[model samples]
Target: MNRAAQAVVMFLLGGAVLRITWTDVYLRYVKQGLRPFLIAAGLLLVVAAAMTLVYEVRDIVRHRGHPAHDDGHGHGRSGQLVGWLLLLPALALLAITPPALGADTAARSGSALATVGESETAFSPLPPGDPVKLTLIEYGYRAVFDGGRTLRGRQVQLTGFIATGPDGRPILARIMLACCAADGIPIKIGLRGDVPDLAPDTWVRATGQWIPHTVKDPVNDSEIPYLEVAAWLKIDPPANQYD
Candidate 1:
């Protein structure tokens, strides 16, 4: 790309990154622990773009009214065309940012439970409360790995969008992220027999207890956990989508 085009592309890229990180939007894709890195990377890219702009100005002044030739160094029309592609990602981020990962993503991923040495993890009592609030991942980890030992007889409240299971049944599902959107994993809690059917991506808060069933991942023969939903109501999607 031409120096001027390169500088503009860099500016847009950097600005796009900053726009997401400076606000809660970044939380939709990655963990909170990555805030610092995102901010730093955005700032560095912006600074580099600014420096390039200054260089471009200096070059223009030094060769006034005599633009540099197409020396196969991005001064040609072809270079400018390719440079425009850099704006695609920025425009998408700034103008048409995508919604958080939802039902479609969960359906594509076969497994709902992911635990490391779950058998060895010791059990702990539910925090003292009439209804303990917990993320879906937290509930899934404790229920699936510990055999629902900590969740037994305890009323827990979980929030997530509704997704349909393999058999086209409603399920309380949420995606957990280890780093960013690309590495998200879906977790689910089964609604009790009494709970009414809900549409896909319907955000809701369900209060319930662990049912302790062998929820094999239907797509794959994998063990997952489920909660016996007692009560639930529709709610707006949370500001942060990832756990």
Candidate 2:
């Protein structure tokens, strides 16, 4: 395309990437978070737009044989200047940083981009009373087969997101992503034994015991050392939700 058209196309493409990367559209529309790298890309886009604008104005003035002088003084340069002015918004966006990515909206979006299934798989032999560090994904895998058979009646620690249930109680939740953060699936565990006092999406380290019970889907349940609340820290989501 010509300079003007190319500039417009690039600007629009940058904006589109920003939207897809930051929003859940990355799941349904595309996959991946493009927001993290946009700052540098936006800078380059601004420079390219500026250069293209300059060339386009020059070309327009040369080709358009419009009124070079109205009242022997006015020139068609005014039209070209006005056209460049219209591109101000596009230029400003490249300079101004956008907002950070927002948390997933469960209502509007409904669950994560992916979903976990009831796998009939059990965990390997874990000694009793061992402070095992397990992620939400690991817990789900164990739940698949008899709710963690080998690790049954053992003490373990689990970490993940806090999802509120219908009764307004916090549930240990984590998301399983297929590709990037966009296509993630939410996994939940009813905090039966003990849980930390944390907000939704807040990361925490649980230091407690485990008790296994035969329940419905995700069959196994653990009795955490409810009283001994070790460390309740907030952190960013981990790279992988599933094991």
* Winner by TM-score: 1
Stretches of model 2 off by over 4 angstroms after superposition: 1-9, 12-51, 54-58, 64-119, 122-130, 180-182, 197-202, 214-243
lDDT (10s digit) by residue, model 2, range 18-97? 65445443343223353356545755775777788888999788979775444554436665566566566655544544
Q: Write the per-residue lDDT of candidate 1 for residues 20-102, one digit (tens) a residue.
A: 98888888778889999988988998999999999999988999998656565446667668779889998887987678999
Q: Superposing all C-alpha atoms, what RMSD in Å does each candidate have to the true structure?
A: 2.3, 8.6
Model 1 ranges off by over 4 Å: 65-76, 114-120
Score every model by TM-score: 0.89, 0.50
Query: Lowest-lDDT window of 10 residues in candidate 1?
Result: 111-120
lDDT of 2: 0.51
The TM-score obtained by model 2 is 0.50
In candidate 1, list every pair of residues with a backbone clash: none
